[model samples]
Target: MCTVCGCGTSHDHDHGHDHAHGHSHGELHFGHGPAGAQVAGMSQARLIEIETDILSKNDRFAAANRQVLQARGAFAVNLVSSPGSGKTTLLCKTIEALGDQPLAVIEGDQQTANDAERIRATGAQAVQINTGKGCHLDAHMVGHAMEHLDIAPGSVLFIENVGNLVCPAGFDLGEDCKVAVLSVTEGEDKPLKYPDMFTVSKLALLNKTDLAPHCDVDLDLYEANLRRVNPGIEVLRLSARTGEGMREWIAWLRGNLGRKVPQAAE
Candidate 1:
């Protein structure tokens, strides 16, 4: 079990070959301990220790990934959101807008290559990772994906993490920043309800705003709550389908990417 988020650690990678990664994924049985009695069998201190160890190891891997990207002058952003937030649509639109910009994508999901295929349809290089029971993608998994993903020098890389609001917030997958994609339909209190995700995000994209009028949601309240958690987070309200506010989103991407890969942004 992944003590960081209590999610399953087993993975069903998209790659064909088998290689060993130094992950501390041990088989954790919840019931039927000593004397045929059901028990959790672990103390709070032990749990904390395990969590620390896991995060520490993950940080090491993240640092290595960061170094490689830096050496290649590649800018990476980790886009995270809950399911059905229109993230894929926004990503596809962004790819379309960029046109000839050197870009690659790392798509993460628990099953199927559907999203990766969508990205490929846009003519951008993409690698899909299927994490069978894993709730989030760790640095180790991303580092492996990078091996197969031909990230170009002075290009932008987008890592679309597993559609999870909680687990993905804690794991740093060597991205330059984390962008939280929240649909206006998801409710205004989402930032308050999931503060960790908002707090960790550098930017929050309020997507599908074209439906805000239909949903009777308060856009101001959403922004207010997002600021209550992450005062420094930049928010962009956009509709991927209608092309509304996409220019600003594209500008933000260029500005951020320029910090690392100036030619790609240009």
Candidate 2:
């Protein structure tokens, strides 16, 4: 039987039907024949085609979202981090630092609106996308949230991706840059182990620096390893819990924003 579709017949043969009987009678071979083989093959091809079509559609939607954001002169940042890496906390601090600036956030998670609630507490317009069973947020989901968000022209939009270091790196969310967050407690060798995540990120946020004294992570060595993989990538070491080293992080963000809008300060 086909376990996937449950449409094919069982291939079990009766022990009672001896081999001697099968020589003359074809009842022993009681499974789908040539016609069924052809049907199964066609079904598999159709499935492959469907998967290809779905990914292509998603890529198109992502490109469209990028164009829309560029036309509006908005900068979108996609935040990727592991669970409990303080991604939401950093976002709250970012919103606070930007004070009175036009900023919106899209929070992605497998369940619960907890992160979105946190962002809202910081006074930023936030939309939560519960991906259900999806491991990562795709561009389609982000685009849908954009419709509900009151994003102004030239505003900053931060997308807090589902807390994951692996799967999220493979998907593009039409963001201007990707920020990868890694806490000191997670170990210094993470960049070497998960090279793809480090490679794709424009900036690496090394969170929980206040706990560096307690952990055995070598900050200098970690930064060296990261630069080896991604030369010229900006790394910010900060602790959201203690608010240490946040100024540098915020300054870098503001500088990037300034480059986009020269009259931003005025």
Candidate 3:
């Protein structure tokens, strides 16, 4: 098993990641040693080597998956968010809102198929990959999932990654961009806390607008914090529950699709 995300004894499977859509390509999981890191006699270099090796293999799979998706003319978007950031709700909203676009979902979860079931409810083709104790989804799983899923060319492919803010940031599943989601119930300083995840993300979605007034969140500070970590990050505030800012979010999604995704009628 790989040391980083608990990848040693694994089986290939697919499950909904909610936003992670956590799927198992060949045996990928993103968790540490139970509760902590195993750092007794291992040197930093050894740990780095193990990480590098694991990432290297994953990157290769990601690249291959990218090529296949791109060849089919699909634009892949990787959604990264902490668990319960309303990722699945946002996805469900997006699927219904898009209306006519060709969209496929790859759900990555530790074991449940719930996310995929929800996406399928929207009449979109979806596959679920069960990570089996994995905290994040890897490229090998995605590549294999593409073979099983019937996503069309010129479509938008959404990879709902395994739902950890930390581990998923490091693995690239050949996605065009990483979209990060933040909830109002969380602290505004989350960007500062998870700098790497925010730094690598191209866009940030500030979700749960319906609860903003009731919560003690500082929206201004939140945006400022995001900028502090990623100077060029673009942010959109929306509530998947109420459909607020859905147009903007949809437009952004279209804009990312090489400016080809159709605009939904208001």
Candidate 3 Cα errors over 4 Å, as ranges: 1-38, 259-266
Better TM-score candidate (2, 3): 3
For 176-225, candidate 2 gives per-residue lDDT tens digits of 88999998888878888778788999999999889899888899988988
How many clashing residue pairs are found in candidate 3? 30
List the global CA lDDT of all models: 0.84, 0.77, 0.82
Alpha-carbon RMSD to native, per candidate: 9.7, 11.6, 9.9
| Model 3, span 99-129: residue lDDT tens | 9988899999998899999989989999999
* Among all candidates shown, the one with the greatest TM-score: 1
- The candidate 2 region of ten consecutive residues with least summed lDDT is 1-10
Q: What tens digits encode model 1's per-residue C-alpha lDDT throughout 1-266?
A: 36432344332223222222233575433323222112144444444555677788889999999988888779899999999999898999999998888889999999999999999999988999999988888999999999988888877899999999987887888989999999999999999988989999999999999999899799999999999999999999999989989999999988877788654344
Evaluated at residue 106, the lDDT of candidate 2 is: 99
| Highest lDDT model number | 1
lDDT of 2: 0.77
Q: Which residue pairs in candidate 1 collide?
A: none
Candidate 3 positional error at 108, Å: 0.7
Candidate 3 matches the true fold with a TM-score of: 0.84
